[model samples]
Target: KGWGHGIKTTCVTRLDAFVSPEGKMYYHRCSVEEVIGRKLGPDDNLASAKNWARQQVLEGKDWRGKPAKFDPDARLFACLSQGEKEKLVEPGAFHVAVISARRGSGIV
Candidate 1:
């Protein structure tokens, strides 16, 4: 269920933490590709690169991190609005499928 290999080339410069309305915390690790839509080069500045990554997410591009696999049923969840998604991920609503980028096989 995980992306076959690591696609990032820079260290995470910042972590964006989200607190669900119900009090759960989710931290998103920003990646270089998520920022610039490409891999990082040797000359890339870790600090500046991370800021760019953060901006992309803030701007609504879905470049959060490495790709992962999720339950097929999760597609239905996609129809949920952002507020609904937060509620579902709360302490209890139903089983939130484990989203992974390392599982090679399963009901992805």
Candidate 2:
């Protein structure tokens, strides 16, 4: 979504901020119109854009100001220890388990 491709030209933008536990703050500009394509119905456009924006806010914070080489594998178990950080599990067997648990209603 960062590339110029697949982005709408006339759109409103927003600056989102995130503060980590260490009190460091990070900010990024987000384009809402680019996220809502013309192909979508009016209601669908709003719902899809909102969902995509929320997911972007969540995942963007996870990688903010970090090197591209950051290895999330190093912190898998650590995040699991904190129930609130369970969203961190992804891209591997842990992610599979999470999907399974969600389907099984083991997680809300």
Q: Against the true structure, what is every candidate's RMSD?
A: 17.3, 14.3
- lDDT at residue 94 of model 2 (Cα atoms): 50
Cα TM-score per model: 0.24, 0.20
* Candidate 2 Cα lDDT to native: 0.43
lDDT of 1: 0.47
Tens digit per residue, CA lDDT, model 1, 22-99 = 333444334424533666456444455456566655665434443334477678887888897776654465665666
Query: Model-by-model lDDT, in order?
Result: 0.47, 0.43
Q: Report the lDDT of model 1 for residue 5.
A: 20
Sliding window of 10 residues with minimal summed lDDT for model 2: 1-10
lDDT score for residue 31 of model 1: 45
Strongest candidate by lDDT: 1
lDDT per residue as tens, model 2, 13-93: 644443332434444233233333334245543355446556655665432322235577667666566665655545564
